[model samples]
Target chain A: MSEASTPTPQEDERIKETSALRQALIRPELGGIVGTIAVFTFFLLTAFNSGMFNAAGVLNWSTVSAQFMIIAVGACLLMIAGEFDLSVGSMIGFSGMSIALLSVTFSWPVWLAIIVTFAVCIAIGALNGFIVVRTGLPSFIVTLAFLFILRGFTIYLPQTLERKTIIGGVSDVAQGDWLAGLFGGKILGGLFTWMGNAGLIGVFERGTRAGDPVVDGIPMLIVWAIVLVIFGHVLLTKTKFGNWIFAAGGDAQAARYAGVPVNRVKILMFMFTAFCATVFATCQVMEFGSAGADRGLLKEFEAIIAVVIGGALLTGGYGSVLGAALGALIFGVVQQGLFFAGVESSLFRVFLGVILLFAVILNTYIRRLITGER
Target chain B: MTARSTHAPIIQMKDIQKHFGSVIALAGVSVDIFPGECHCLLGDNGAGKSTFIKTMSGVHKPTHGEIIFEGQPMNFEDPRDSIAAGIATVYQDLAMIPLMSVSRNFFMGNEPTKTVAGFPFYDKEYAARVTMEEMSRMGINLRGPDQAVGTLSGGERQTVAIARAVHFGAKVLILDEPTSALGVRQTSNVLATIDKVRKQDIAVVFITHNVRHAMAVGDRFTVLNRGKTLGTAQRGQITPEELQDLMAGGQELATLEGSLGGTV
Candidate 1:
């Protein structure tokens, strides 16, 4: 009788334990997850109101994301390696313009033009590396110089390509399938192609007056994104080259002591990042079917944002390839989500800013925790 | 070649002179480090102790005199050459990466690998297995090999570095104040590690300013004062108190002792 009803603190403790078990995760990253959900829901509702879930809407976002994913992968690598390549955005414009001007205006083979363009970009990356290594200059300053110089090149590059004509010619490297397929080409033959890509020709589809024929297979953009992610992850994790990257960023002195040529690694990393930008720029031309001077303007920041969102520490010791992949997806989702929610362009920019700020804070705190624990 | 005798003096430095940028840091210092014996070099701040160790370790190339390692004339341009020559110096700061695992730091640049068609395949499993085996041989019972090195105590970190040198076939291990900053228990642990290392037939050159700690493990003692060796004496030749007197600069010690003025 005494055990059943009176003075039983054990049962009370058990009840208290159950209640405590329901406590929520209050960490900032948890807040990020919650924010992600809230934003996603808000976008879905707007999309429903504005009919953004239509086939056209999907196509639009896919095209935008396809262009972004390739460059974002390289930025992610650089971020994980504890460095930055601010010149990438400029590099793409310059590289693309170089190829287009060479191939279309100069009557050069598309392959040769592409090769020459990439070589120039690689050289620029090496120069950036050499300057960084010799001067111990912060990459931020060096790459920022590239940004302005490249932008200036865009204004004058057309003039150099076609001095006789008053107006410069636009290159068609993007529309060239051979270059596209070589770098990040797509071969799609799947059931999903029934709607996603240009659908089966005349398979009981309405004529132009009655209804538009459905066209679908794989989105070339998705193809580029997938290929880039694979390349980034493998290059970073599975190779000796990747090991060098980790060592170089982790501790330059120790790495050098251990016989890792750190300056060479840095130069290579910059070159690799530039090559990634060129690939991305190539895809942009293919997808858009044209190249211009402002092709890759300010896109470097977007790649950086994706990397930071993906879980890379800025201080050069820890980074993740998968995180960058996920980060790119997150960027896509946010952009589409904003569009679907019927938000104004101004509002979209504001939301992006907020998300970027939150990501920066969370990424920094996690890095601190890791460094402090050790 | 047969290993140096357990009792033979493997490293014998005589009149070692080293200058750094026109500063005569170590001037005419001599010490004999015998296999299987713990030799201590004791001195106060700026007492040429660091310079002596640097000269021995090949960090700073000596200006004059000889460093005989395993009965060979030694001139090491860098620490890597010295390490290869079986003379290992563990710096005070300990160059192990804090974020890396104990096993990774144990092997570090000299990680063991198996060759597959002339290509190196880093046998990670073998490294883990051997890191455990070697560390246990050094009398360290760690929780796990995968544990981050920063988790270990100062003494344990020193032991790990010492154990690495031993496993890599270092005949003469020079510890640069390895236990100076460690707490009492940790320092004792280091002394025990030094003892274990001595049993393995390695000659240890223990550098420190503390007489008590030095006396705790020293087989032969050398004290330096102001860029020169005051004297090098076998432990049996001089009492600890006398050693302490010499290290404290006997003139100041005498003044303090004289104040007691025949009170006894």
Candidate 2:
């Protein structure tokens, strides 16, 4: 029996190699990323004539997306860890509203009320996590109930506001500020402002320069988003808490058997997600200089879509925070590109549907390949 | 029993009965496992083999049974309780995450902690070092501890699961069909590990349907049939044919042999 096709000649290394490669690519999270790029390329080819690649196009849509991209990043971590928080949309409104109501109603200092508002948000987020983990109910149910409860209470809050929002003291964060320069620094150049979508990638990169805006370059909100993403990524990839998140999501029973406090991990993930949502709402409210109830509507689905597009699985076990950031970036591009291209906004829904469908199909195909069931 | 077998039985089951709804999974099943002995439990499908192991591992609240450990009679309420009592079961499928690094999968929930409260901090350097050390102790030479458990052959996963239990204070290890899904080489590798387990003085309850494998490691054999114990035999007391004769229910095999015109 020569090495040439001897019967069952043991080491058929090719089969093993192929299966190994298949396993890495088949992961549900990676599937999402590969799927996103595939669909995005197709859209680019078909819609290229729309000038979505131009600066004004980038300016318009990216500004819109950056708002959600900030929150979607956190939502990705929550989903990948096998939990959900539906109250995030509510958290945004409540956090923004709470900050405004506190400053206007109590005549408290702007900075003091802002700090207190976040503290409260973090606590509430933590509470949601604690309850879900202890009760063993799906986080979706828990957070949804949290949403209805918050919504009912939200109407009562605006009564304390002068214009139901536009509170005193913190207007610079949203509207514009000259006093902002006294402390905000000289590097805060006129065109270098973070408030304007006209900054680089969004605004034609040449024209659309911010004429006059207060809170200036690297608005407190954008700075918070970047910091949160970095921290969230570290929390997910480098710590024991991170591993526990994967284990709990991957196999709850086995995780318990291995001594993981699965409930605790789940609760923390939920709370963290809600906290991010609140921060998002607060930041957006600050940018526009007012807290409105209508803010963050439908953002839950968008955040989930971002996560799925980033390559995180809804079923849990595998995901990446960085991938989520990329996913959010993709959304920013498409949305901005379409707006500046002057394509009908209604057609945007059609694009979303197509991209969503493509992402799922490619993700499933990749997962199947990974399992060797394809 | 040899003079070397004089160590007290690590695990002793007495009249253990388990019922799922109305189905009798285990009926007065009893067995004693001594230190340094690879005690084999042989059964066909639906022979209460799983039920018997579940009872020992605290997965089942036995309707009626007494589990004696270290000579003290007790009952375990959950799998965690069983593990705490130094009892661990390795299922045929090997409960380990395939996508995780071997070091991570090895530690899972019991991750070596750098800080002890309000949060868990992974001791990455410690984990990597200990994982490799543990693998070496189990006679597994690998390229690195960072390799995923899924990449290892089937036999390697089984060995890792067993080593994990032993490393974590498991005095009595229950292996559920560890070699059943494995290839020939893999089966031998597991069998060799069982021998290693015996030399380490940890009593083993090896479940299998293969007679040759049981004969290879077992000093004592138990045959279960239809949720009941048929009989038990020492290695010196029965031939391979005799063991199968008992397992198959001699009368049933005889009738089938006669019906086949002596082909058996």
The 0-to-1 C-alpha lDDT of every candidate, in the order given, reads: 0.71, 0.73
lDDT for predicted candidate 2 compared with the true structure: 0.73
Interface Cα RMSD per model, in Å?
A: 10.7, 5.7
Q: Of the candidates shown, which would achieve the greatest DockQ relative to the real structure? A: 2
Taking all chains together, each candidate's TM-score versus the true structure is: 0.78, 0.76
Candidates' DockQ values? 0.14, 0.29
**Tens digits of per-residue lDDT for model 2, B37-131:** 88999987888898899888888878987888889987787788888888888877746766566888788766777764766667888889988
Candidate 1 residue-wise lDDT, A237-288, digit = tens: 5445565566677667665544456788888888888988888776665555
**Model 1 lDDT tens row, B1-264:** 124324557877888888878888888887877788788999889998888887887778778898887777788897778878788877776455554567866776576666667756556677789889877776666555765666566787888888888888888888999988999978997898898898887888999988888988888889988888887787678887788778878878767867987231
DockQ of 1: 0.14
Lowest-lDDT window of 10 residues in candidate 2 chain A? A176-185
